[model samples]
Target: MAVLGLLAGCSGGVEGSPVAAERWDPCSITPEQIAATGLDPEYRDEGWGKGIEIPDWGRCVFHAPGGTAYPYGLDVTSSEKFTIADARGRDGNLSVRELQVGGRDAHMYKTETGKSVRDCSIALEVSTGVVVFTVVYHTVDGVDSCQVVLRHVNDLESAIPAGPK
Candidate 1:
C-alpha cells in the first residue's frame, strides 16, 4: 500500500484545462499575400509540422524560393491564449521595441543576443489575442531580418483583424 501511494505521488500529470481554440487561423492567409512576401505560396506548411499541435495556436510557414544560396522562411502564428505582455515577458527576447502596424499595437524583437544576423519576430495585437510574424534565414546574406518581417507584416496587415477599439 505504501508503494502504491508513492507511485501515485510520482505520477506527474497535466494540470488545468486545455486552452480554447484559436480565434484566427494563420493558414487562412491567401496565396497572393504569401507571394507578395517573396515566398513560395505553394510551399505553405500548416501547424508546427511533424504532426505536432499546440492548443489555442494556429501557425503557417512559408518558404522562400528553392535553389538559392540564401533561403529564408517566414512563419506566421496566431494565438488565442498568449498576449503581447506574455511575449514581452518571455526570456531570450532581445531588443523588444513597441511599434504600430497599420494602427494596431505591435512589437519587434530579436531572438539572439549579439550583433550577428539572426531570427527576428514581430507580434501584432489583435482582437482575438496576438499574431506574430517571424523571419528565419538559413544562411547569412546581409539581409535585415527585421525589415523583412516588418515588410511581411505590412503586406499582411489588411488580412489581420484590428485589435480592441
Candidate 2:
C-alpha cells in the first residue's frame, strides 16, 4: 500500500508539491496548539520530506517526555489524491464527524476506545487536495488524539496558503 501511495502521489507532478505552496507552513502550529494535546510540544522533528513525493508533505512527530515516537503527524500538501474515507474508521478510529473550518468542508474522526488511542485525523478540503492532521499515540498511553485536533485545528487551517477555495 505504501508503494502504491508513492507512485499515485506523483500524478500531481512537481507543481502540486507542498513545498511549492507559498503560505503553507507545516511548522506554523504554535506552542499553545501543541500544549493543548498535553504532550511535550517542545520536542519536534525539523526535517522536511525526505522521501515522500509531495515534497513538504512529510510527517511531524511530537514526543512526550519518556515517551516513544508516536506516529502523530501534520501534513499540508497540494496533491489532490487522498479522500476523507482514507482517514476515517482506520488507524483504530471509533467515531467520525464533520467539522466547520473557515467555511471549508472538513471532517474529524477519533480512534477506537481503549486503554490508549491509536491516532486521530482531520481531513480538510483544500483547493487542490486535502490537509490531513494526524495525532498518534501508544497503545497504552490512554491518550485522545482527537483532543489535540479539536483544540488546534484553526491553527492548522491558518497555515495553509491562500489558494482556490
Candidate 3:
C-alpha cells in the first residue's frame, strides 16, 4: 500500500460574490500520486466533512472563513462511489446526485431549499483516478465558495503526477 500523505482542506465555488485565493504548505499529493505511492485514492472527495450543519447542501463542501463551520474533517476512502452532498447532522434532508465530470463519473447533491446559486461542480483525473469536486454555498458576508473550490482543485492538480507538465 502507498504511504498516505498529509491531508488538507479545499474550497468550492460560489455564485454571486468573488473569492480570494488560498495558499498552504503540506505534504501535497494528488489522487494519482496516491496511487503511485501504492494507495488508490478512492471515494468522491477525500476531504469531505461529516455531521456539519450546512444551511444549503452545496455549501457543505464550500466553506468560508468565519462562516458556518463544519465540525467534521476530511473523510477519505477507497470506494469509487463517493458522496459530495450529505446531511449527516440534520435529517436525511440532504441528498446527492451523480454527474459526468472531467470525462468521469461524479456526484452533486443539494437540498431543495438551496437556491439556484447553491450549486456544486467536480473534475476528475482518469490517469490517477483523482476527483476534484467543488460545492458552492452562500455565506454571511464571507468568501465565495467558488474561490475555495477552484483553489483546492488547482492545488491537487499541481501536487499530483510527477511527470512532464
Highest-scoring model, TM-score: 1
* Residue range 1-165, candidate 1, lDDT tens digits: 999999999999899998664579888889998888777877888888786878778898888778444377888999988888888788988878899999888889989735544789999888778899998876667888888889989989888877867
Q: What's model 2's TM-score?
A: 0.53
lDDT string for model 2 (17-88, tens) is 465433234556566666665546776764454654545344455554454554444433333455445555
TM per candidate: 0.80, 0.53, 0.31
Candidate 2: residue pairs that collide: 72-136, 92-112, 93-111, 116-142
Q: Flag regions of model 2 displaced more than 4 Å.
A: 1-25, 28-42, 46-57, 64-80, 83-94, 111-117, 139-143, 162-164
Error of 1 at 145 (Å): 0.6
lDDT of 3 by residue, 1-165 (tens): 133332223334456865432222122444554344332344223133576432211211222233235311121222122222221222432444445432344443333435534433343333322333444554434554444444454444445222212
Clashes of 3: 10
Residue-pair clashes per candidate? 0, 4, 10
